[model samples]
Target: MKLLLWLLLFVLCWPLALLALLLWPLLWLLSLPFRLIGISVEAVFALLRALLLLPARLLGHRGS
Candidate 1:
């Protein structure tokens, strides 16, 4: 519903929509580095968690 209103506004004010379209790619490009850093940080944390759990997993497998 909100999207429909926005589209209506865009139709009524085309220049605003055009400006938003032009800036979208630039904004995404600027944010790409931060996104990459976030992904790397998440991966590092996942690896650390797996390392921490390895001993427990091995013990469980031996018992089974």
Candidate 2:
């Protein structure tokens, strides 16, 4: 369905569609650093949370 709309758009305005197809990958490559930074930030937060929780988990295990 989405492809049909895009195909229609391409048929109607091949120039704009051609420009978008060309720019899409360039835009994605330009945005890659931001994506990587976001992923790393999330991983750091997850590691911090796990470290903070480790003592409680250990204590609970000892009780069990």
The whole-model lDDT of each prediction reads: 0.91, 0.91
Clash count of each predicted structure: 0, 0
Q: Locate the minimum summed-lDDT window of 10 residues in model 2.
A: 55-64
lDDT of 2 by residue, 2-24 (tens): 99999888798988878999999
TM-score (all chains, Cα) for each model:
0.71, 0.69
lDDT tens digits, residue span 9-64, model 1: 87889988789999999999999999999999999998998898889888885433
Off by over 4 Å in 1: 1-12, 61-64
The positional error of residue 41 in candidate 1, measured at the CA in angstroms, is 0.3
Question: For model 1, what is the error of residue 58's alpha carbon versus the real structure, in angstroms, after optimal superposition?
Answer: 0.6
Model 2, global lDDT:
0.91
